[model samples]
Target: MRTRSLTSAAVSAALGAALLAAPAYAADGVPPGQNPAATETTNVTAGSTPTADTPTGVPSGVPSDAPSATATPSESPAGDPSPDPSSSAPAEGTGAPVFGNVGSDPSDAGFLTVAVSSDSAITEVSAKLTQRHGAEPATVAVSGFTLVSGTPLDGVWRSPRMSQLPSFGSYDVTVSARDSDGDDTSASGVTTVDVEPKPVFADRSISPAVLDVEHTHVKLSGRISLFDPISGETSPLGGKELGVSAQYGYSAVTAADGSYAIDVAPRLNGENATSVAVSLSFWIANPDGTNTYVLVDSKTLPVVISPSRIRLDHSSVRIKYGVKASSSGVVEYLYGGTWRPAKGVAVDMGYYAKATSSAAGRFTLTYPYLLSGDTSFTVGTSLDSYLDDPYLTASHAQFKVDVINRTSICFCTSWLDAYSDLHIQGSMNGSDGKVPPNRKLYLQQSADGKSGWKSLGWFTVKSNGTFNLDAYVSVPKGYWRLYSAGSSDYQPGNSNSVHFNRTATRITGFNAGPEPVRKGRTVTTTGTVQKLSGTKWAAFGKQRVYILFQAKGKKSWTQLGSVKTDTHGHFTARFTAKQDGTWVGVYLASGSYVDAESYRDYVDVR
Candidate 1:
């Protein structure tokens, strides 16, 4: 038993005060054994018990009335078994006694001490406590009852290891021990403790800091920071409340590391934009029974939406398709007045037209759509782009398509009826006179294989004859052919159709421009053209003419005079110089089909 000694006078005074203070007790004089005798007193022997009269009284010594501290257990009333004011031993048959201090902070591993004592030998002992807040129930080894006389047995008890320790609270502990005779003794106590707050943190950076929309998915990511001191060990913060809001409804929660992610696909229709924010918060308990919360540092990142540059190999409608990305920002394109997929349309062969954005741009889109007829496209970096003040750029084109007529001869009225009124502007080239200039010419096959004829239609043709023929050729479903017609009407007899399968178009008239020379000088020069004449040379609309001039240096050609034949397709130029000297004569031809090729002739201007 834990004990403290009190001065005799102090003990007497305390007893008097206790009896007076207790509402149920009305005391007169103090009891015995507690006070010193008036003369030198002798200690009470083991067998000799204190008498009812002794030197016990208040300081006044007038035998003041008070409760008696020295009373026999049998002297107590029949029902009341209260101990003598202060008794060292338990009631005669109270059984083996168990004692211990209440444990605390059980959320963490902690020690519990239990001591047992008994008048007789003890048999069984046990400690009883429920596992609360995810802790396992303590084992029997930590809780047992059985004691022997004078054998101060101490039990080392440990609070169970817990998966999740609750906040600071009260917990009860009861220890029960039994003596050899099967008599039970028990003691109970309470311990109040506070579990340490679990380490926590919050996200403090921008979400989707780098927006990417070209892939039809906006990749989102952010930074989460920890305010607590975290080392090698990390605690999971699952189930934390995390919120992310965009121009449209899009939200999500943080994962174990306080990091959160979500995707937002901007509406490709009308306007394309991205505007959003993210927030997070959670709670931890305080020692004083109050709750504290941690909040994420909210951040807003501006989303950029780029205009889609649906590029192609050529701007003409019938041209082959090519792909290229646009500048940064969200953008939408329209097809037949409705929004098109980021990928515009499929052209000839497996090639496709698509609206693409630069890096870090965002766009919401769907799949495989069109871009035809008076369609409109819009692009904006802000959310309110759909209003009347939308940012958009639009244009229009037309096409005049025809069927390919496959035939070797021009079998007009007898073989096939010529169809011509398929006209749409700005997309197809029109024919005038002999042949269209570098325009696509499509042909249709004749129904009768023997006829072997093809006709012209609208399409795209480069100056070099290479083309993405946008023209449609309706044939009678037989063997057909495609080819290029050389320069038309040069002399009315130029090779009109050079079948692609037969051979490449011949460089008919590779020549130079008109020569220039001074008027007073006499100059003579000659120029030549390759493949100048055909079956009807004079009938060809384009005629070859050459001029002569006095050439000063590699780049200098002065004009004198130019000449041409009378429907014979030959020409010559003359010049007269006031001063006589050696002069250079350059030759110039009217019709040429070559890149930077010219002929030069030496002359004397004497």
Candidate 2:
């Protein structure tokens, strides 16, 4: 066989120059080391290869005069090795194979080359590749090696062509050989491979970068590319997928031109704006027809949202106690320079009342008027999940509602001594079943009960809603009513009107003759007529007074005669006393005074 030299130094120098000044590239968009152009076997020599211990063309770090180490199986039991057709039965007294330099291909990491020599004729050769560190150890078998050296017993071997290894890390390489003597020999060593330095993203952009209520979804677009280490050139990479880290199960595949566009809906979690992460990835096709997912590049994006507002129909209201009141309004959000309804949101109406908005964003809050004062009603909503999107900020509206209590007065009258003050009593109350202390009430009188009303006196209310007053009236009779002026929290009210009659007179110090008057004898009766004037009784002049007599056995008194009072208010009348009876003087009813009567005096008959 013709011999050929492998220039390992030239390959190492070329690879180092390319890697020293490599530019930073996006790792998520392209599968490193799996490029078809980089996997070709053009740089490698075929057939009749020289031994690693040869004086010429020796790999770096391996001494040409170094003695080969004998290959031996490890003491620990190993997994089953791949079956090879070039194996032969074992023979006794045959020495194990010796291993020369063993290493990976520098130009392409897909091939493994080794030098092996045995005392007996060699039959089979294989290599086992195992990952050095991982959660689970990964192992691959590489077989069908071709002999490229002097003889079957001592020769150089090369494994079949392959794509780049799946991962970038240290690997344990075990080269095993079987000879015609049925002897097995193996040697283990470590090798490492790095991912290719290449740019993955040529250009990237996002549409509607700032999100708001009007724009809830974002469009991500970008182009993928690959860098060639040998030529330092970039080209488009197709068949890649783009994804958003914030959105699960969302992805878009790139086109033939390495361009991709995808729409993603992200949640702000009730914040005004949020950041999201997006990534690019591609599937790498392996020599075994399986595919592997590799991430190339990632980026962060920002989003924003609009605020919300609450509207009310009325800013203030007036209501009576025990009555129900309602307030209506709508909830809206700022979107695209317009106000849009925020439906199906929970709103808090003041006083612990809550309501849910309708499809039109309208809501009505109802509550009973239980207080007799001004109350503030605040309706609002906060940042929470509602409708298609959550409101980013809190909003509210305020208004005032005045609740007035209904008032009433129970009025009545009582008669006291004619010489004493007049009496009037009543109870004042409200619909809330409470009487405000020190509430002022007025006693009013009207001539016709419809017009010309005048206040007679004013009184203060008690805690129990009751009041009374002794008022002197100069007018004989008039229409009377109780009135109460309203406060900021209570309603004005009036009691029923009443007609009063006050004109009346009385007689005092009356006498009927001396010695008990004999029967058939003349008797005299005298008295004074008095009337109430300014809370005091005074003598009245020119008033008509009547004198009457009643028999002792009669249940009624007979009117004997009438008399007129002198200017001094004194009146006298003489009459024959013919029976044992009581005699008394009376004043008949008149337009100004109702009537007057005197004390009775008895006469004994002879």
Using TM-score as the measure, which candidate wins? 2
lDDT per residue for candidate 2 within 213-254, as digits (tens), equals 566667767666553322333466677665455544577778
CA lDDT, every prediction? 0.31, 0.58
**Runs in model 1 lying further than 4 Å from the true structure:** 1-130, 133-136, 139-197, 202-204, 207-274, 279-352, 357-606
**TM-score of each predicted structure versus truth:** 0.23, 0.39
Cα displacement (angstroms), candidate 2, residue 32, comes to 12
lDDT of 1 by residue, 42-146 (tens): 111111111254322111111111112222111111111111111122444553443333332111112232333444444555555443333453322344221
The per-residue C-alpha lDDT of model 1 at residue 412 equals 10
TM-score of 2: 0.39
How many backbone clashes can be found in candidate 1?
61
